[model samples]
Target: MTATGERNALDPEPIQSRLRALLDHHPDGPLPDAALRQIRTSIAPDHRSRPPSTGTLKERAQRHEAESAAARAELIESIHAVDPTPEGLLEFGRHVRRNVEPSGFASNMGAAEFAMAPGAIRAAAEHLLDTGTSLAEICIGLNLLSLAPRDGDSERIRIFIPLGRRIEGTAIKALGRIGRAGPHLAWAAERTPVYRRLGAVQAIWDLPEREFSELLYALPVKQSADLVQMFSALDSRPEGLQGDRRFARILRDAARPGALEAEPEALALAAQLWDEVRYGRCALLGFAPGEREMTTAGFQALLASPEASASVDAALAATPEDPDLVWLRMRLNRAAHSDPPLPRGLAVRVSVPRPSIATQARTHLLLDGVPLVEAHFQRGHSGRPETVLHDGRGLEALAEPRDVKIGDTGCVEECCGAFRAVISRRGGLVEWEVRDTVLKDPPTTRLTFDADQYDAEVVRAAADFDWEWPARRAARLLRERIGAESELMSRWECELAWTGSWSPDRSEMQYSFYYPKRPSGNDAYVQFSAARDVPYVPEVDDGAVMAVVDRIIADLRTTDPKSTARLSGGSREYAEALGFPWPP
Candidate 1:
């Protein structure tokens, strides 16, 4: 009021002069007493102070900031009195709220403070890992230590589990030092010693069946103790794995001979698993069906269909207790009434036809009426082109070998290759065929049968074309056989060492080196590494192992297929170390 010559309602000074100034400025008289009281209450306390600061608002703000900074400095010094270990920091963080509330001070802290002392943090983390405190708890402690926002616990775990090299500003960075030694270093640092020992075993969960066989030769006998412990921990098991035979096979592979003989729980699990696999596989592979347990009415109704009744009768005659019978019945019933997806169209188209007249002649392939690829022949020949059928769209197609005319010429004919389906780079399906001949290209034909026939054939082909399951089965069988027969010949332990990056097309190469435990032999124990294109995988029951085993036996059989003699020679025991009960 004094400086601007305006009325100030909250002012303690007399308002007569201000009221006169207001009257001069406005034709209306002074505000009413009720309105004046409200205006005084609405005015800010600082604005109505006895006298405003002689300095401007900016200068006063700077002075207040300086005073707040001094108070915050004192608060930080008190916080620093607390020890900086994980537990200490946790307690300090709790106390910070009381200090902040009383001082009316607020400040943001750097999240990196948690990682300031790597040694202390590492020690604390080691203690936590040993105690089985999960990564989630560790992250929460870290956030509190660093005074960072504590949110996204699940997101932090997801990011930490799959972290690779090149982690920066991430919780993983604070967990361990970024050494060039594989990205798994952090994972190892954060797990129990038992879990650390089984890191390679856990890889089985991610690897494809073909690579699973690598586990046979990879694990050392020294690690068996830890592996057995892990199996014992899993004895209670999950409900979903009630009839899962593959899991049983894994347990058996981990346990040494006579190891689980005393473990009744493990033994029971193994027996149940064996029954499930032996009979269930037979049912799934269409080898045969077993008996059914049904009410009288159900049995009579089943008898109404001669085929179903015959199937049931055959199952009854096959085994006294067919463990897979229940599962098979359920699956068959579901399949009979299932509504599955159909191929909307073919996946691939032929860029060009094979077997040009002047150029080398060959054939082209198509899937679902669409052309996929062309195969060029080394040399041209004359005859009617080979008969090719698109059949129809499906998950898979079987190649039927057929005698085909070489070209337009009738004089010569050759056995043509089979057709199969594959995915293209553009996420489309493509049909492929092996071109073993130098003759004319194979003919491409669309589905010729009626809609009903086409649908039936397509569904039938799809039904029998589950390659993934077969691969898993073969893996399991190989692991079981290998686990039963294979042993460390050398007394010393062997280590599984990875040689290169992971690749989908080829197996990862792993080599094992063991020093002779016997004093008499200076010979080195060297296990064969994977072939150039093969990857290492843990053994499981699957069809992928079947193909791998077939290849192994085929290569070995080149010399002697009938001989049950295992591959025994040199300081290293060859394929015989994992030979099956019967000749390949």
Candidate 2:
């Protein structure tokens, strides 16, 4: 239609290159629809996407290898028929798998429906015996023979053997094709005692009728990599509301139920895909990739956290056998749980060693992810004990430890004292000019601790709150000190801390008082704080520790019954609570 009237030839650029170029753009962004569509196209082929002619010699070799698996299977079958020992068959299967797996893998064209008359396969197989020809040639006739059972109606046995009344259980297993045929394989899987754990895995998608394969297993395990990648991409689909959420959803979905526990071949696919899931190169399921992936792992690791093991334990949780997996989970969870960059300068407390070193720690994380303490801290111990590290290995390396000082005269004593926080972030340290000397840290005596053997230790942190005599002593010391200095008039700091399901908001606060201080070592200002951050209003007199204990009892009357109940045939004088409160 141009003025030149030559009827200019219309040329349309191929979409594949345009998509590849866009995907490879330097500032590569989350995939665009066009590129995603092209990728889908490249994966979904009619006859199996032929390898590009311009592909490298290596690529061509790979492609040829993939297509020639049937040839390998035939050669192996000849060897198998002659000697069917377990080791011999296994070796053949492994060798065949290694060579056959090299094919760039056709996308899972979806599972072959179970309806593919087994009788036809067996007949074609028998036909090969009579014809004295190649299995490849027999398969051609088989493919044609397969047509009747594959496409036509009325389903029936038609297994590998026509004359026999029942199908060979082994032949049935080899037919774990997609669609209706899957149940037959599932039944075989259930019967296979040696690999029965895999049966639970197969039952993961148990069919309603033991029939039609609507969501049949598509693509052989080796051939499913690209398909899984594509599905992972679909799951990672971004929201019009974009950001990290999209990436997160993708990985979460990729880690679905059957993924980690499928067939060896399929399990291998899941692990490979899990690696890509971790790298977070793409978005998933509206989450900012790498979201739930960390939480699941971290949660599992937390059960064996030193603090949980040593202190706040419900039941012992099992740790993963794989330490590297635990480490990966911890690092990722740490990042996923990172606080947003702060707008104000962050403040932290650090304590120096003295008689009983301790300081008031202050922090404003602005995110819920940060732990009040390193709750899962642990250290592994050496059976034969090492020379340097506390655990006889690396401190905090073998297992996490729930160890910290509260308000005790001696260090080990303080470790058992009822306190709010034990492990204070080292960065929060600061010194106030008291008089001639700097307060060693903990408000009262020098914090004595067993400095036996610890290097830059990574401990699982916890609080100690065992009450009775020591808790009584610490309360009396504070009351006697603060009551003497009522004139100082200080800041009112109240933070309701709880462990597990205690309702911090509704636990009736008895708001009590602290007495004035009498100058002990000449520090003018008196520190009027409980050994821990808690709702228990401490007594003004030495007789007062019981009042808070009484309040703990009163709340228990109606406090969610799930929180407290008599373990033994219990009486009035005894009770217990969950978790630790930090005592200064």
- List the candidate 2 regions with Cα displacement exceeding 4 Å: 1-120, 123-177, 180-284, 287-321, 325-584
Predicted candidate 2 versus true structure: per-residue lDDT over 175-203, tens digit per residue: 33323554344323222221112322233
lDDT of 1: 0.30
lDDT by residue for model 1 (1-584), tens: 33332223553332223333433454321133333333234321232434556588899989778877876666446444656455664444344422332223321324343333544443333332222122222332332322322233222222222221111122333322222212232223222222122232243223344443343234432233223223222312222223334433343343334333322223222222222222211111111122111111122232233454345446646742332332233223332342242233432111101101011112222233222221122122222111222123222333342333222221232444333223112122223333434335644432222333334544553343231222323333343443343332221232222122121211322222222221235443333233322322322234544566556434433432223223222232322343323223
Per-model C-alpha RMSD: 33.3, 27.9
Model 2 scores worst on lDDT over the 10 consecutive residues at 376-385
Number of residue pairs clashing in candidate 2, backbone atoms closer than 3 angstroms, sequence gap of 3 or more or interchain: 72
Each prediction's whole-model lDDT (CA): 0.30, 0.28
* Superposition TM-score, candidate 1 onto the true structure: 0.20
